[model samples]
Structure formats: structure tokens, C-alpha cells
Target: MPTSLNDWLRILENRMLYLSSEAAEQVRLSAKEGKCEGLPLRVAALVQEDGSFHYAIGFEDTPKDEDVRFSDKGVDLIVAPASAGNTGRSMYPFEEIDPATLASWLEKGESVRLIDVRSPAEYAQGIIEGGELMPLHLIPLQMPEAKEGEKLVIYCRTGMRSGQACGFLSQQGKDGALNLRGGIVAWAQQGLPISRADKDVSVG
Candidate 1:
């Protein structure tokens, strides 16, 4: 039992990708057969009628605008926004934060540094309280640092690009980098209020 998001982050990062050499070769061959060579493997979790889950993997030529891409051992993995939620941990190349869990973090007054990695126009619509606007394109240029025991939570419109940000941050050895599972849509769905970008600035 990992109690903190940071703990969960470490656990998930190690499990993001698991492919034996032979399996990797087989996947490449299958992609070539399907005329999907050079395309990324789009993975998703499907909920079965029995309330269990089935993991789906395929080579996707067309990906959504908000999709996140990760490279593991030369294989590109494509993931759609909110797609990670089907699996409890999101299994993207980074740690994921559920909207409800985040709300609880805020309620408990935990140290969380929230970042909104979306375009300026997208960020203006409404943002999670205390979110600092650091557009996805600008993440590399202006990444945030977390203090001891502070969680670095990043999100975009659909939790896709922000997931990319988390991957980048983790590569930089930054801990507690969590992506909001479904972005703001999921947040609003949980009855969590979105506030002005200037108000409720808790993490400074």
C-alpha cells in the first residue's frame, strides 16, 4: 500500500512497459502485416460486461489531437486522454492522479504544486485552483520544481499532453509528478469546482 501519490508514481513507472525481446519482435511483425508499420501502438483498457477489464493493443495510424506518445525500446506507445482510467493506474509512461484523490489531497491541505500544461487559450476556459499555466510546448523550457513532500501534479484539457509532461519530469528525476487522470473534464464530472486562474493560489 502506497499511501502517497509519490509512492504510487514510483510503482507505476516501473510497470509502464513490459515487453520481452521476442514479444517486441512479434508486435513489430504484426504491425507490418496490418500495414501499420511506423505507427505507434495504441493501447487502451476496455471494460467487459462482467465488470472486469481487457487490455487492447493495436497499431494506430490516426491518433487524437490530445493523445500522448511514449517511446519504449524503440516502440512508440500511443494513449488517448482518459484512456488510462480504464486501468486503475492509467499505465501511461507516468503516474496518474485521479480527480477525486486530488480533491482529497487539497482538502487535507497536502503540499501539491499543480500545473496546467495546456495552451493559453485552453487554460483560460477555467483551471484547477492553484494551477500554474505552463503550456505543454513550454514544459521543457519552464518546468516546475517540487519541494520536500510536495507533489507535482500536471494536467491539460484531456490529461494526455500533461501525461507527457509527467513523463518528461520523471525522466528529469523529479518525483511525485502526477497527471490528472482525465484532465478537467473528469474533474468537473466529480463535482469539483473549477476556479479562476488567479484565485485559491495555495501552492506558492
Candidate 2:
């Protein structure tokens, strides 16, 4: 298992103790499989009128814990920290950007270093034009080498990795590292062009 996933499973296992026996077992299996990457592990429990208990696990909404219903619709959707340095990780103000505002900034000749924090493989598959490839796994090693004065606009497929990268950068005192609110998927989905050319050419 990758160390990162194994570490997540360990923390999730401890949280599973709060769940019913069946749910805990399901989580154990899911953790070992690496099937639900980038998604939350949701468990739902239902009690039949005959007092028998039933459980389901995955990303489904269901009832749990003595008649309480579990669902993300009304919840704040805050993802729990998965890594060890979460306490010290700095967070980007991602929720602050609006689409129009972000577009306006992009229109201006901003000196921000637009970053794509996906893996090298993902970057090769596709990426937003002008984005600097800085995979999330490499953030710790690269942060110290980053120049301080430039604004770092980070992004990833759906913004998760970018948010994490921003946090890592903030921990390294690069407070200017702001994540693209929606990432390249959002950018491309909105009809923006993506470039396949070797961007590292310029950085080198």
C-alpha cells in the first residue's frame, strides 16, 4: 500500500470504532482496496422494525445511529484531515473566488504563477495552459526552492490537490500561494483551452 493511503486507513479505522460492527468491517475492506480515492467513505445503518440491524457503506446517503439520517445535502461537507502535518498546514482562501471575478483576474496580465499540482502523468494527459506542473507529492521538496515574491496560483483536476498544495506552501511561509477555486477541470469545462506542449521548457 502507498504510505499515504495506509496512513489514511489507519486514521479512518480509529474513527470506524464509532460505527456499527458491519460498517467497521466494510471500511477495513475498502481501505485495503484503494477503490474510493478522492471520495469520502460513507456508512449508513438502518434498523428494521423487528430490531435487526442492516448497514451499507460507500458514498450513499442513509439512516444511522438511532434514527438519525446521514446525508451531505445539509452538511457543511468539510473533509477531515488525512495527513500528519494537517495541524500546521496552511489553507488557501478557495471559497472566496467567484467565477466572474476569477475570469476578470485571468483577463488581466497578472504575474501569478498558475500551478497544476497533479501527478506528472496526469499533467501529460492534459492541463490548463500556462500552468506550472508541481505535483502535490512534490510540494514539500519544492516549497523551499520556490521564489517568495511571485504569487503562486495553484490548481489540480478538481481543486483538492491544489488546496493541499496551497496548505503546504503556506506552512513554508509562502502565503501568496492561492489555489484556483475550481481547477483545470473547471477551467476546461468552462471552455478554456488546455495545452499539451512541454511547459517545463520555460521553467527550466
Count of backbone clashes, every candidate in sequence: 0, 0
Per-residue lDDT of 1-204 in model 1, one digit per residue for the tens? 233344334434544544445446655755675577897877554443554333334566566665566776677776543332443232324557689999999999999999887767667779988888887667778768788889889987766567667756655666457878778878998899998765343331
Local accuracy of candidate 2 as per-residue lDDT tens digits, 34-90 = 454334444222333553322222332232332223223222112233322211112
TM-scores of the candidates are 0.56, 0.50
- Candidate 1 matches the true fold with a TM-score of 0.56
Q: Give the residue spans of candidate 1 off by over 4 A.
A: 1-38, 42-92, 199-204
TM-score of 2: 0.50
Report every candidate's CA lDDT.
Answer: 0.66, 0.49
In candidate 2, the residue pairs with backbone N, CA or C atoms under 3 Å apart (3 or more residues apart, or in different chains) clash, namely none
